[model samples]
Structure formats: C-alpha cells, structure tokens
Target chain A: MSLLAEIAVSVLIVIGASFALVGSWGLLRLPHLMARLHAPTKATTLGVGSVLLASMVYFFAIGKGVSMHELLIVLFLFLTAPISASFLARAYLRAHVAPDVLPPAGEQGWATFARRSDDAHDAPATSATRAPPQD
Target chain B: MSDAGLLDHALAFGFVAFGLALLLNLLRLVKGPTTTDRVLAVDTMVIDVIALIVLLGIRQSTQAYFEAALLFAMFGFVATVSFCRFMLRGRLVE
Candidate 1:
C-alpha cells in the first residue's frame, strides 16, 4: 500500500462517516412523521452510498478487481424507501381519521334538520327529527 | 500496510460513526409517535446495515460480505414495498 493510496482510503472513510452522522442527526432533529421521513430517506441513502463507494475503492485499489455488486443494494434502497414512507403516511392518516369521522358537536344533527326542513315544507317539524325528509 | 494505514483508520472511523447512526435510528424506532415514524426508522436502519456490511467487507479484505449486503438491500426493498402496500390497501394479501 503506497502513501497516496492510504491517504485516499482515509479520505473516503471520512466522507462516508460524515454522511452517516448527518443522517443520524436528521433522524433526531426532524419534527413530525411526514417531515422526519425526508431525513432518513435522503440522508441515509447517500450515507450508504458513500460508505459503499469507500469500500469498493478500498478493495479495488488493492488489486481486488471491481466489486460493484453494492450498486444493486443502492438501487433497491432508492426504489423502495420512498414508496414505504408514502404508504405509511397514508395508513397513519386513515387510522387517525377512522375514529373521528364525526365529532360530538351536535352539528351533524342540526345540519340534517336544516336540510329536512328545507325539503318538506309541508311537515318541517315531523320530518326534521323523524328521518331526513326521505330525500 | 503502512501506506494503507490511514485508509484503514478512516474506514475504522466510518464504522464507529455508522454504529452511532444505528443507535440514533434505534432511538427513533423506540420513540416514534406514529407508524410512519417507525417505518422510517426501520428503513434507515436497513440502509445503515447495508453500509456496515460494505465497510466490513473493506475491513476484512474480502468480497463475500458484498453478497450479504446485497441480500440485505434486496430484502429491505421487498419489506418496505410490502409494508407500504399494506398501509395503502390495509391488507398485504389484497
């Protein structure tokens, strides 16, 4: 291993480590689920890429030929992380709303009554509470 | 290995940093208030693991670890896709 090669390796490693650190920091600092999703999705993907590139350089510089298989992993990661994040967000929204579709403010009944009264002028009082004007 | 000493040290440093990243991600996994948070944490962890495997390959001077890293990446993708599909459709089978 020549001095130049050693220096190059060290540089690569430092770059990779810095990326990982940034990704972690983003994880801790970001607010909310939707916002937090961006941190790992972008930072971590680049972090992993940097580290993998460092490894490839380290091995190949030493006469190990090309080890580009890590590229496949990078490809897969980039493809899936976003999809999962979106799906999870959608699911969270659905679950959060399922229980509160109707609030207990008595507003629903009032709206129904108003509509019934408008439709059945002949029997406003009876139609208001009985059903909904059968319309 | 003198010429490569600095490189080795740098790689080692990367390993340590990556370990810390893993810990931070784990914290997110533990403290996430929503399912999306947990899923994001898991996704980040998978990425970190893949990076770790590649670093290990460099450290050990072997190409074998690449295979494991590759597998992890593939599985992570599949798992993420399936989880997302489940979230969207409310059922993995459907």
Candidate 2:
C-alpha cells in the first residue's frame, strides 16, 4: 500500500477506537438515564463509521476496487440511531420519570405519564428501579 | 497478514481500545440504576463489537467478516427496538 493510504488507515482507526472508548466511558459514568442516552449512540456510530471507512480505503488502496457495502452499515445506523434513541427515551420517561419535573403538555400532560396530572399517585412500574434525577 | 508496520501498530491500539469499551459497557450493564441503562449499555456493546470485527477483517486482509458484522448490527437494532417496545407498552406489538 502507498504511504498516504497507510497513514490514512492508521489515523482513522486510532480516532475511531478512541472515540468508541470515550463514548462507552460516558455511557457508564453519566449520572442519569436521559444523560446516559446521549453518550454512545451518536459518538460510537461515528466511530464505527470511521473504522468502516478506513477498511474501504485500505482495501481500495491495495487495488481490490472500491467496496460500497460498508456504506450500507453507515446509512442504516444513522437512520436507526435516532429512532432507537427516541424509543429508549420514551421507555425511560415512562418507567421512572416523575411528571412534575416535566413541562406541562396541556391536558394530556406528558405522553409518558398517562395520568395527565402532576399528582403523586403515579408511581410508574414497581419492577423497574427508579432513575434518580440529576440534582 | 497486514504487512504495513504503522498499520499493524494502529490496529493493535484499536483492538485494545474497543476491548476496553466492551468492558466499560459490561460494567454499566451490571451496575445499572435502571433497566434502560442496561439496555443502553448492551446497545453500545454491539456497536463496539462491530468495530472490532471490522478491524479484524482489515488486519487479516480479508473480506470474510463483513457479512457477520452487518448482520450483527441489524440484530442489535432489532433487539433494541424490541426492548424499548416491551418497556413502553408491556408488549412487542399491538
């Protein structure tokens, strides 16, 4: 492989790997579920994208022709990350979040809490551990 | 079969970093304050494993791992969606 291609592959891999590590660190250490949700979903996707891009470059530089399939992973991930994240956020809100801390969503209140008021009666699911709000 | 010296060293660094990422995910999975935290950790683990597989393919100088990596990613999404669905509605579908 050419020196330029080699350097590009190495740099991309290092960047991708470090980002993945840091994102997971954030995921593990963040104070709350909503805060944790912001961690790995975006940064690590970019990390994986860079790694895949490096693979494509390495292969093409060695004269194996451009490989397009890796892009499919990138496209699919970007499309689905937000959707899955929203689903997770909804799950977190419904299972543990108290209604008063959230802004009023009119008569319906927040969709997560179906009780429609800031009353203390809504206890959410007993089976799930409560997510403590950041103080 | 990687012949480039710098590339080889970089790949080793990547292997260590991603492996450590998996360990961190495992820590969160075990020490979750809520079920959603565990689910999120699992999702991140899947992404980390995908990166490892890609790096392995590059290191081995072969294309054999691509299909497995793609399928793993798809399964990760499906599993995450199902987890959320179950968590939100207490059921997978209407």
Off by over 4 Å in 2: A106-108, A114-135
lDDT of each: 0.69, 0.85
What lDDT tens digits, residue by residue, belong to model 2 across residues A31-113? 98888888898888889999999999999998888887788887888888888999999989887866556665665345564
For model 1, give the interface RMSD: 9.6
Best by TM-score: 2
> Candidate 1's residue-wise lDDT over B1-94, tens digit each?
5643576678778889999999999998999887667777887888888888888777777888877887888787778777665544445552
DockQ values of all predictions: 0.44, 0.58
| Native-to-model Cα distance after best TM-score fit, residue B14 in candidate 1, in Å | 1.0
Which residue runs of candidate 1 sit more than 4 Å off their true CA positions? Answer: A96-135
Q: Report the lDDT of model 1 for residue B61.
A: 79
